[model samples]
Target: MSVPVPKGFSELTNLRSLSGFPVHVDMDASNSWCSLQELEPLSQLRDLTLYGIEKVQDSRMAEKAMISSKRHLQYLKLNYSASGHTIGTCGAEAEQQQQQSVTEEILEKLCPPTCLESFILRGGYVGRRLPDWMCAPESADFKSLRYLMMENLPCCTQLPDGLCCLPSLEGLTIKDAPAIKRIGPQFQASSSVAARGSTASTSAPFPKLRNLQLIGLCEWEEWEWNDCEEHMDVETAIAMPCLERLQIKNCKLSCLPPGLASTKRHTLRELYLYELTNLTHVENIPSVVKLDVFDCPELKKLTALDSRLQKIRIVCCTKLEVLEGVPALDSLVLEDPTMDTLPEYLQAVNPRYLKLDCNKKLYESSSSPGSSEWDKISHIGKRDINCIEDSDTSSDGYSEED
Candidate 1:
């Protein structure tokens, strides 16, 4: 449906969340951007997921102006677009002077800034660094931010140290930051550096942060944990003691750092490793409750699991075949390349859930495609495998940020 008229949109003042914008990758003619533009009048709006990047390009000027002008918003999800690199004027040379002036004026006029709770810039060109004011609590900008997720920002090279030190930040997910060679002080300060970087040592700790996920960072060769010790005094670098969940994906590291061993184990519950080609072993994740490994071909075996581990999932590991230790598990998911049969010990657990998919090349003796696996799992009151795949893979053209 087309968007309601700009003035008429205010009639729906009670609106809180809007999702499922049309993001058809192929279709280009649909111009329902006005409907999205109409969303600005939603004064109580707290959550938004704009998934139609192809459509957003048509009315970016209007949308950016509305978002920059509107206040009281807590959550915002802008559609992904490589072209969304900059938020101001583009090719219109004639109207550029007037438009730029108005945009700056509006941004300034939007005083004191709203207490944004969660801001996710997904699948866009976030331009290698966050805006200087993004995480500044003293500036009262994002004073309420709790979760921040930026995905597929190919050009983003580094995150400001100030961004990491946000007082209210709880969960952070940075995906597909191919150019981001390092984080915080390991990377040089660009013009995006705010206040010469925080004096707070990396070891000084982030009292509130609970979850962190770093994925698809091709150039992220190393996480400079050692550098933190040199730059930050011993007293300040030991801070992020509350971290509970850590997931690293598609990185180049062959092994985790010595400092990370058991340091946060008292609070950490889950650990995930995905497609880290150089990673040959999984170690130091003590007290972890759940272990998930996917596409790590170099990993050949499962090490001793902590007493607290409830589940372990290994998927598509061609070279890795054996799993040891951990007598009981709540669940196990094995998606492998080749297997002649299920590991004999795997059946002993009687797990609440178990998934074996696309292992025909690995296991020639297991039940065929639609066999006892589905029957066993379905009778346990769990979702059917086909249904689960459909639910996850369907292009609903929308996503939600936490």
Candidate 2:
């Protein structure tokens, strides 16, 4: 059997399955034949990924093609810089100008794309604000959208207000967006939205949201509900009732959001904070079953965690001096400890499985295995560990430091 290559996609009126169509668009110069306007021919496409678009002008044509195919599109990923499009690294003003042009083109061509469950915009000149139609529940055709990721958009500033309307939205990630200093306006507990309408509606809360990740945000100063008020209280804001996991990396956040405590320690099950350099506070890690903090050199303590915390892994915090409050934890992993000995209180936690490696203190303690209280509930060991510092280790029982 021979696989026949159609002379050019141009002659085909209806190609049934164009797997990996625009994602790796057969941009082999001579082979590039799918007209940008006639993508509807691939009517069965459930997933469409576009990658490495070099020229900025090509994106305008591609945007139109995406909108046209939205009806059958379940997953859409637009990656603009495999050719290393320099629009992102250029000065903010130049990037802004390009985004404005791109935004208008996308907006004009966009008609509520339906059936989309996940939409991702990666490495391109995205405008400061996403179009209103994209955010509006009434306007968007994607009723089942569960994941939305926007990465490396240098010009984007805020999330759309219609975020609350996404009934199925489970995960929202904003990464490498240097200009986005805040997560929400009306969504925050304290905002002007409360004054104009029901405060309850503004804080409708992420009923299905399980994971929230913010990374590489340099200008982000604070994440508090009712930031406009003189004080933000955790007790007032609605909680993330279903949130189970949280991961923050390389973001210069001063501390955890103040309203997280208001969640009443009800839903949070796993927490990972890494490379947060200026982080000085760790007040509320509620009912967390697993916690991994890595490469946070300035952290002075791991504070306010509940007794139910089951697993704790800490690495390379040169200044970490205390782990006094965590209790009822089943597993304790300490690697590359900053101090010569484990914190005095850590020896007393009730973890059933304990692993220690590479730290001179834990290594010394390994010889005198029965000397500490941790020996009662845990199996302590001294071993050489090898793993990447930034990789996620939650599933295999390991996490990277920073």
lDDT against true structure, model 1: 0.56
Across 1-402, the per-residue lDDT of candidate 2 in tens digits comes to: 112234355345344334334423344556634545445455656666655433335455656465555466677776656235544545597765775676545544543365778878776645666665555444224458899887877666766656555557789887887886776544432222322333344343455678888777767666655322233344324545567788888867778876665535478888889888878768666678788888887888777787788788887776776676765766777666344555555545545555654443344454343656235323333222222223433222222221
How many angstroms is residue 114 displaced in model 1 relative to the true structure, after the best TM-score fit? 5.3
* lDDT of candidate 1 over 1-402, digit per residue (tens): 423332344467787776644333222336432444455566676666665443333334344336654466777775554553344446765554443344334323222234777877675543434554543433224557788787877655676555544557789888887887665442212112232344533323344678989889977766655323344434324445567898999888776654455343367788899888877777656678798888787886666656557888887666664555665566677665344444544533455666555433322223334544433333322321211131233321211111
List of clashing residue pairs for candidate 2: 23-49, 190-226, 393-398
Q: Pick the candidate with the highest TM-score.
A: 2
| Alpha-carbon lDDT, every model | 0.56, 0.59
Q: Provide TM-scores for the models.
A: 0.60, 0.74
